[model samples]
Target: MKTIISTKYIKNTVLAAAALFAVSATAQDADDTSSPFSLSGSIDTYFRTALTTSDADGTYAPEGASTSFANQTGFALGMANLIGTYEAGDTGVVVDLVFGPRGTEATFENDVLNGIINQAYAYWNVSDKTTLTVGRFNTFLGYEVIAPAANFNYSVSYLFSNGPFSHLGVKADFELSDDVSLMLGVMNPWDTNDISLTGEYSLGAQLGLYDQFFNFYYDSGRNGGLGFEVDYTGGFDLSDSFFLGINAAYNTNSETETGFYGAALYPQITASEDFAIGLRGEYFAYTADGFDDVPVIGLTLTGSYSKENLIIKPEIRLDSWGNDFEPFTDNDLAPSSSLATFAIAAIYSFD
Candidate 1:
């Protein structure tokens, strides 16, 4: 087989860090050859159709960079993931792998792929209330995760799509109390999984509060000299079967002086043990260097049905904006400033 390995940012950093960590750990670590390990993951597929006739594929306008999960006109494979975790004493390791268009496109930073690794990290429990970790890992900025099985809606929000998906670096997590904790780290530049080859490094931190019925998480980071962002997320359980979640974010770049601010609300109701419904209402706007602020509103409704380890999600979404922007659809067919789409997805998970 033919293969290529690029000297991208993250690859070099990951290799050097992993080697150093291994050497330091091996000297003081005790063997746990008898310890147990486990494997688990999920597979997902979907069909989507845009309601607009502006494009042959009925592709929705304003679906921009983030809604590509179900952009295909017909049946499409979303992703296949496999996760392996092993823990023995104070040391642990995790390896997550994924494949599919959504998987590749989302993390193809620097246009490099090696076994489609989503996260490969190792950690040591410094103490009962503290831990230190290194390698690639998911970001703590958003309420929605990279896994489809974990999200109520199949389509991703603009905040999640546009924000950093993962980080490559070292971090320390501290549990301060029963309801509060803190995470601090230094990492590669924002939105890039590998090192950026630049000497500049980003700083990251997350403060979290988790209680019985309410949870709040806030994340902030500066992308070296380029920009900075703040993301806040909160969740509340109003009743046994009803819940609400909110997310807001603001990001600004130093060079351009442009900024983006957005907010989203997620409300869900459980109709039964096997059926549920949810809605997401969101508003997003951006200010450019020379142009006035432009904004849009999006609404999404989704239903989920579960049977054993299999789950099916059906969703419909609409987006509306002002005439200050170009018509959402291609060829300017949908000049009315709105577009719509519907999609259905099936997911199966196992251990």
Candidate 2:
């Protein structure tokens, strides 16, 4: 059978894939290190294969990578993440750098004259309730992050893949109470490290209560810019050995009326001291003005084993789409709505 993929999906894929990928505050900081002036980093490598897809002729555009990172075929290098932080009294600075396939993709926009940079910012704790930050930093938008060790599943989710990876702006973080917090900032658009070529600025805000966050981003609509995004992320511990994570986001551009939305659940069980298992079940969809909604469901199962600072993850993922969207070719070389993949990754961190 033959099927014509819609232009909307293509546009959405390109747009989402270009993101360095964004994140949230209540989430663990990918670059945070113990103590001050500590040099820490991680190295990751993986072996991935398409379970039920054939890519001999390279006809499938995304092949088996529908999300982000860990999509490269065969044995691949994820990236080298190096972070340096210095905190003295109330002031601190962080220089986070990355290099490799995953790093390149994460810093797609900042590769101009400065190679690859994951985040570079200076922060100061003001008073007991407020803090100020400036320079480029990872976005406070999604559950997943740029660092491999920070995620339960090596393969990123559609929600994280489509959001802004990092931002070049200034922000203020306020601790309202023992359990409440708020953060607000303005920046030169998404993924831009230098000046905003469009001369347009974007706004970001996050409100945290009892470890749950409500995030928002906004910009004027024109020439395919970001109009707004609303996101919610949180987690609950059902028991001592089991936890559930929830994330949902919606984004729309008023000018083009094009965007995406998604929700995902991460349920994990710590089976032993050095082993854990998790599942990421997600539903993601794209919306456009003149096209039917194209929705996809992704399920990823991952097993994690750790010894000291080294971790190994084995993952299996499957994705199926509706609205006649066949992004993969089956083993029989036929257009198919579903794709399966398997991968194992080795990650080591040092300080």
Candidate 3:
């Protein structure tokens, strides 16, 4: 009787697994039908280490320092995006629903998933060269973005996040030629949850042109003034790989005017098909109108090797803000002309 019971339990487990596999296969086949819905999303993770030092022993202190010498580790899981597209001949509609982690939050209440509708919008393809989109959507402003591999610089730059993350309004996109495209939109100036300010709205425009080797973008928001950025990526056969990017923007508010700028350069040498070494350098500066025009600069040097989907990166960085800014007085760290940090990271991607 005991032997018979054990065999029955094993048989039930196998039957359950078979049932799940059949259901998954059926769902996949259903997706292959000419239905109007699709699902796609990506996940990204990174670890960072930040360090600071002062010229005087008591001048500066780290805000959130780890006790271990190892760099701080952070993990994030993004919600899988569900996209729906309906086409009734040439005229069609498309909608996107985006959900994901709300950054490095400590609790579930603050996660992006709490906002059920990350993105809800509609679009119409008026013609082969024109499209109109209305609702809440991501902005097309800078070169770097929330996407991981799309950016060579590890962390978010001051200009990228300071501009605009999303817009709630209407936008028109036109493809002028093979190499040129333009986008014009008017938005609520803030997130979807915020009410529009009286007599205040934000208008933005962007123009882009390039062939991958070189690209240029010009964008401006009513309140953020105008910004111009350019990127260049090209290299000779086996000599060297290089990339150079720069951006500048100026803004004026009722109380003050500010200027922001950034530049970065990366050069790599591929010693073998699976082995490479690279160096990255970046700088940022900010100046305020009425206050002392103090500037801040940050730099990073990295060495990386990649094999298929695996990547290993080791980096060192330094940050410094001009004397115009006040320093922290209560920590063991000291504020100096510059602070340095060292970190190593590994990543793996699967399909």
Best-fitting candidate, scored by lDDT: 2
What local lDDT score does residue 280 receive in model 1, on the 0 to 100 scale? 87
Off by over 4 Å in 2: 1-36, 57-65, 112-114, 221-226
CA RMSD per model (angstroms): 9.0, 9.1, 13.1
Model 2's TM-score against the true structure = 0.87
Angstrom error at residue 19, model 1: 26
**Candidate 3: residue 295 lDDT (0-100):** 57
Per-residue lDDT value at 164 in model 1: 76
Shift in Å, residue 74, candidate 2: 1.2
Give one digit per residue, the lDDT tens place, for model 2 in 114-160: 55777788878787788888887777888877777767788889899
Per-residue lDDT tens digits for candidate 3, residues 244-307, read 3444444333323655555544444555555555554545555566666555565656665666
- Per-structure clash totals for the candidates: 3, 8, 7
What TM-score, over all chains together, does every model reach? 0.83, 0.87, 0.63
Q: Tell me, by TM-score, which candidate is best.
A: 2
Considering summed lDDT, which 10 consecutive residues are worst modelled in model 3? 1-10
What is candidate 1's lDDT per residue for 1-351, written digit by digit as tens? 111111111111222222211212222226644434656778999998777646665445444523446667778888888777777888888777789876776677343564387788898888978888898877766666677777788887777776777788888877788777777888877766866666666777777667211212222334434677787776677777887778888877776677777998888888888888899898888766888777878899999888887889999988777536754563456555776878999999776
Against the true structure, candidate 3 reaches a TM-score of: 0.63
